[model samples]
Target chain A: GESVGLHLPTLSVQEGDNSIINCAYSNSASDYFIWYKQESGKGPQFIIDIRSNMDKRQGQRVTVLLNKTVKHLSLQIAATQPGDSAVYFCAEGSTSNDYKLSFGAGTTVTVRA
Target chain B: IAGITQAPTSQILAAGRRMTLRCTQDMRHNAMYWYRQDLGLGLRLIHYSNTAGTTGKGEVPDGYSVSRANTDDFPLTLASAVPSQTSVYFCASSVAAGVGEQFFGPGTRLTVL
Candidate 1:
């Protein structure tokens, strides 16, 4: 079955440093990708998204990069902050599936003070 | 304004019992979705409704059922609770279900014993 997966399960970074999270997807037909952040004891929140036609999209301090040829996606945070500690998930969707996203296992990002 | 609200913030149910998790959105989005979040496996869609009175099964929908009585309310029902069904459930809604961002609820934590 086609799925979205993360390369790393956990990432620790110091405050004020840049952080990057990587994700790999198996579905070639997927055209839409999104990144979500989930804090402890809360539901996932949207961070940013990118379409297949575009290679990168930026939102605030976050940027989403999509590579269709490699079936890879990434989320980059400009500066790590204590509040940025949470689980980040990458999801993929396409028109063929009515845009129902397939989420990744998630990467836990911990920002250290 | 409340974007999305889920009832029974947490629940502990016994096996074979029937339970329904309520979800309501004030945004009046046309698309609603129900997803379960597990430890290692991120969020998996259980069921979704493109609009009122229409429903579709998602990645995992065996023990769960959903109904979109109207554009504002979409409830997920578990006919027979099992231990495997113990997980945090989140309800989300989007404007029309394309590449648009989906607003998520606070989530309902269900523990089946």
Candidate 2:
């Protein structure tokens, strides 16, 4: 879906497990991608971002991998803590388009202790 | 830092009414954006301004209008409110567009009756 009005996909995982959320993008010109974590009743917080020029980038406990070949992106969260439980979103920004971002349908991560 | 502030944290409006959602950013960023969040979908851009005095329509610009006459204020106006327009609206500003991190307002939850 183009807007964030679609149903969110959900994933249930045990605490201390690894979580992987995937996103598919349609625009190949997207060069900058970022993963955001949004808790209930709050705005999205920046997680990690990767450039199309680079295949991968990592933050403290998160990693973002971009595959320009197939227009795919994935976010990996290691040691998925309960605090990490939130809606994970993948947003891509097109360098060719003055950095306008196109967001993907979010995946809700539920970490059960 | 009160980076961004949205007025009337939440509001309820009647159908066919005129309503304006206000967003302000103190970071002095050059770009401001308005997005409406629904249940499970991605954050579709309603409208964006790269700088003061300019605005552009986004994917879901219908039923919404934006104005950026100054560097600090970007208000979203709903000509005639409808139930379909009820959602949590977020205001964001970035130093630059793209992978540049965007600072978000707390968000205004609007419900149309």
Candidate 3:
């Protein structure tokens, strides 16, 4: 069975702190992974992505790390701000050519000022 | 530019009724997808289109149908609405399939009684 799951349901962090969100996927064949951010009443926005060939990828204030051996993926947000409060989801892409994705349950991060 | 737009921000409908959710993208991407988001379950793909004339069923496609008559539009149709179908629907588009980033719409909240 293919399943993508998050380690935490919620995370509360103080402003300017660093936040790390963890995710795990059961599909070893999945070669591509992506992170998404969803705010209240809005659809998800793409944050970052990593391929099985790479161990890490960084974007603006976010970093995505992939550990293929354990099928684990993590998103690190630096200097977490109040505007960063949102639900984050990790998705794994299938081996097919269509880039079909399986999303994780999601972890809600609350950045308190 | 409006990357992606979904019609009817929110809707309340009775069970057993038919409903259609419209999705359009101004990016003129070759791939479009429909997904439903639910509490604790994450977002599940309902259907997808690789091009203007090709469509495929996704993980949770049993209760939904879709059509992609053109590159900009991919509409999802529910033959008979059920309470279980209540969820926020999102439409996404990517420049190409398999390895590109996806841009998501705001989402449409649907409720059934």
Top candidate on lDDT is 1
lDDT of 1 by residue, A43-106 (tens): 8999998989999999999989988889999999998899999999999999899999999999
Query: Where does the lowest 10-residue lDDT sum fall in candidate 1 chain B?
Result: B95-104
Error of 3 at A102 (Å): 0.4
In the order shown, the candidates' DockQ scores are: 0.90, 0.77, 0.86
lDDT of 2 at B32: 95
> Candidate 1 at residue B85, lDDT?
97
Steric clash pairs (candidate 3): none
Off by over 4 Å in 3: none
Weakest 10 consecutive residues of candidate 2 chain A by summed lDDT: A1-10
What TM-score, over all chains together, does every model reach?
A: 0.98, 0.93, 0.97
A best-first ranking of the candidates according to their DockQ comes to: 1, 3, 2
Clashing pairs in 1: none
The lDDT of model 3 is: 0.93
lDDT string for model 2 (A1-113, tens) is 33222134888989999988888777766778888889999999989888878998888988888778977788889998989889988887776777777777788899999
Candidate 2 — which residues are off by over 4 angstroms? A1-8
Model 3: per-residue Cα lDDT over A1-113, one tens digit each = 68899999999999999999999999988999999999999999999999899999999999999999999999999999999999999999866646888999999999999
